[model samples]
Target: MIRAADPSDAVAIARIYNQAITDGSYATCDLKPVSAESRIDWLKQHQPPYPVFVWENQLGEVIGYSALSPFSIRPSYRSIAEVAIYVDQAQRRGIVGGRLLIHLMKTAKKLGFRALVALILEKNQSSFEAAIGLGFQRVAYLPEVAKMKQQWEGVIWVQKDLTASSQ
Candidate 1:
């Protein structure tokens, strides 16, 4: 099931996130995993309009999370949002990521967002394919945008319009 994330879900989310960082799929730093306290602080700071959603299993464990943050600081960009999704390694191919993404898209539209953008690492084929399957179009690609673990990585920018009301 997918639902709004609570402070209690922080540890699980942090664990999965840290695992992604370690696995090289996400290309993040090797810092210590974020604590629940920090997650609570983050949740408190974001306020109402912005939200974070999590995918949960039958055991109530958090398998993945997706969030929508402001796409740009300009006032004219207020209707756009940047989306991020991360899933537990074990749940990679189980559709958890897809469900979380779909939920984010629905929630973003309901919250009056006009568009949703995804910044994806080039090597992450699964994520790119998932976004394409969800109707997101690749609008740009930045070659050698980031250097991770001594290797250069590219980034793909994908977008989807959410202005059309859902039937």
Candidate 2:
């Protein structure tokens, strides 16, 4: 099941996100593990059109999470949003991330977003393929834009035009 995230889900969200951060999975650029308290503050920033959603198991554990965040502060970019997803390492091979992302996409469209963008690491082919399978198109590539552990890496920018999809 997937639902809007609340303050209480911070801990589980942090755990799943930290897994990506620590495992060198190239899934995220965050270098440090986030605290649950800080995640609560992050959760507070996401409201209405831009909100965080968590995937919960039958036992009510948060196994994955996704969110639509403001793509930019400029008024001209208000119609676009950036999407992010993180799932527990144990659930990475499953459909958790895909489901969470699909949910986020539908919510973004219904909330008036014209496009949703995902910035994926160049080495994270699984995530790239998943995003493409969900209808996101690669729009740009930034080479050697990120330095992770003294090594340079690139980022792939993918976008989904919500207007082309059925409401």
Candidate 3:
């Protein structure tokens, strides 16, 4: 099940995200594992139009999470939002990530966002392809944007139009 994340869900969210950081999957550029306390603050940043959601298991554990953040601070870009998703290492290559993304898209449209964008690491083919499968179009490719583990890696930018007609 997916629901709005509260402070109580911080630990599990951090655990899932930290696993991705340590697994070297290049799912995220964040180099350090975030603390539960820090995640609480991060959750606070996502309010109203922007939100943080968690995918919970039958046992009530947070197995995955997704968030919509400001794509750019420029006032002209207010209609565009950036997306980020992370699934538990144990649940990789499963339906969890895709479902979270789909949910985010719906929520973004409802929140008055005209478009949603995702910046995926070039090396994470599965994630990049998943976004494409969900109707996001490749907008651009940023070369050597991040240096992970002493090696430079590129990024792929994908965008999904959220206008009513897109549905």
Candidate 4:
């Protein structure tokens, strides 16, 4: 099931995120594991229009999660959001991540966001293709701007128009 996240979901969400951070890190630029306390604080930053959602099992365990965050510090960019998704390593082969992403897009639209963007690692082909298939198009690329595991890597920014009504 998918639902808006609350403070109690922090630990489970943190575990899923930390797995992605340590496993290969193609999923996120953040390298180290974050504490639930930190995630609680992070969760507070998201208000009405921008929110975080978690994919939970019948037992209420969070297996995956996604969110829309402020794209920039400037108010002019408030209409744009940076989207992210993460799935537990144990549950990866399923459609969990895609479902969470779709849910985020829907929520973003309902809240009147103008656009949703994803800054994806160039090497993460699955995420890139998935975002493209979901109607996001590449807008820009930062070449070798970050180094992971001693190797330089690039990132691509893809965005979807949220103004259009969904089919």
lDDT against the true structure, per candidate, is 0.83, 0.93, 0.94, 0.89
lDDT of 2 at 12: 96
Q: Give lDDT: candidate 4, residue 157.
A: 94
Model 3: lDDT to the true structure: 0.94
Scanning candidate 2 in windows of ten residues, the lowest lDDT window is 158-167
Report, for all candidates in order, the number of backbone clashes.
Answer: 0, 0, 0, 0
Cα RMSD for candidates in order = 2.0, 0.9, 0.9, 1.2
Model 2 alpha-carbon miss at residue 126, Å: 0.6
> What lDDT is reached at residue 157 by model 2?
100
Candidate 4: stretches off by over 4 Å: none
Error of 1 at 104 (Å): 0.9
Q: For residues 25-137, what per-residue lDDT tens digits would candidate 4 score against the true structure? A: 49888877899998899889878777999999898789999999999999999899999899999888689988998899888888888999999999888899989989999
lDDT of residue 117 for candidate 2? 96
Task: Encode model 1's per-residue lDDT on 1-167: one tens digit a residue.
Answer: 88888788888877877887778785243345676678777666556577988888999888898888888889999998988888989889878888888999888888988899988888888889999999899999999977777887888999998866551
Better of 3 and 4 by lDDT: 3
Q: Which regions in candidate 3 have their CA more than 4 angstroms from the true location?
A: none
